[model samples]
Target: MSNLVLFTELRQRLDDHLDLVSRVAAEGDAESALSMIRREVPGLVAAVHALVDEHLPDDNGSCRKCRSGPFWRRIPAPCRMLIQVHLAVGAAKATTRDRTRWSPSRHRLQESSVD
Candidate 1:
């Protein structure tokens, strides 16, 4: 299947899951809905990351968003390209790590650190 088809399928599945969770929440099972979301969120993120990486080309060496500086009056193409590349790589690595770490059983070991 094409990447667009795969991405659409994943997006539909996530939307369906969220709809179910919303229904559950409306029935006064908010915590259970939250748990379901927490379980699926990693997969959703991975799907999004995959879609973006598939559609976008890597390092065309041109900053499409390159802007001129007010003080310097110059568009820093090199710096912008470097920053974009760094962010892209970092995002890919983080998404991969998150996908690897996600599991249904992993949720049981989570603690409420904020409280």
Candidate 2:
């Protein structure tokens, strides 16, 4: 599928998943909500990969050795911008998990300081 069409579909899917996640969270089902969000990640990654492959410059094929280096610069500006936005969204999603993992360490530090 074309990038525009794929992007639109992905956006809709993401919205729907977000709504479901919110509902599940409200219902006190954190595991289900997290599962729903995680399930959508692979599809998003695949769509982005397809977009990159479709937009890569012709010279990209010859640079197989340094596969990751130059290919991103070849993607069109709009697609690159979309990718950046997606990455930011992913990082935002990960923040909750990061915070959860850090909470124990933070509590331990607080306890040690109190003594």
Candidate 3:
């Protein structure tokens, strides 16, 4: 699959997981919610690895085409910025946390700190 498509799917899956956690938390079943989140952790980590494997070129971590092709000799600045933001967010979320208190605002703050 194309890198963009794969990334989108992975992101969507993450969102779905977060949404489920939110719903379960609202129900006040913190223990069960935490259990489910722990169960999903491995899959989320794998998905992140998959994204890196697909997006980063094997040799130098640059896009193969953009590195060699005449695609303006650059990727658009906005896109590069977005990728940086996404990666920063990912890094922030790497620290394991108690899912019982995993609020979306907290998730976003974690992501933003990478900036």
The digit string of per-residue lDDT tens for model 3 on 14-88 reads 788777864674464778878876786678678667755545443544554335555456453333434654755
TM-score, candidate number 2: 0.35
Give candidate 1's root-mean-square deviation (CA, Å).
Answer: 13.3
- Give the number of the best model, judged by lDDT: 3
Best by TM-score: 3
lDDT, candidates in the order shown: 0.53, 0.53, 0.57
Q: Estimate, for each residue in 1-115, the C-alpha lDDT of model 2 and write its tens digit.
A: 9999999999999889766665665464678867866876577678768765554444433323223545554443344444554555554454342442212323221112221
User: Model 1 — TM-score against the truth?
Assistant: 0.32
Q: For each candidate in turn, give its C-alpha RMSD to the true structure in angstroms.
A: 13.3, 11.0, 8.4
TM-score of each: 0.32, 0.35, 0.43
Query: Global CA lDDT of candidate 3, please?
Result: 0.57
TM-score of 3: 0.43
Model 2, runs deviating above 4 Å: 1-28, 60-79, 82-115
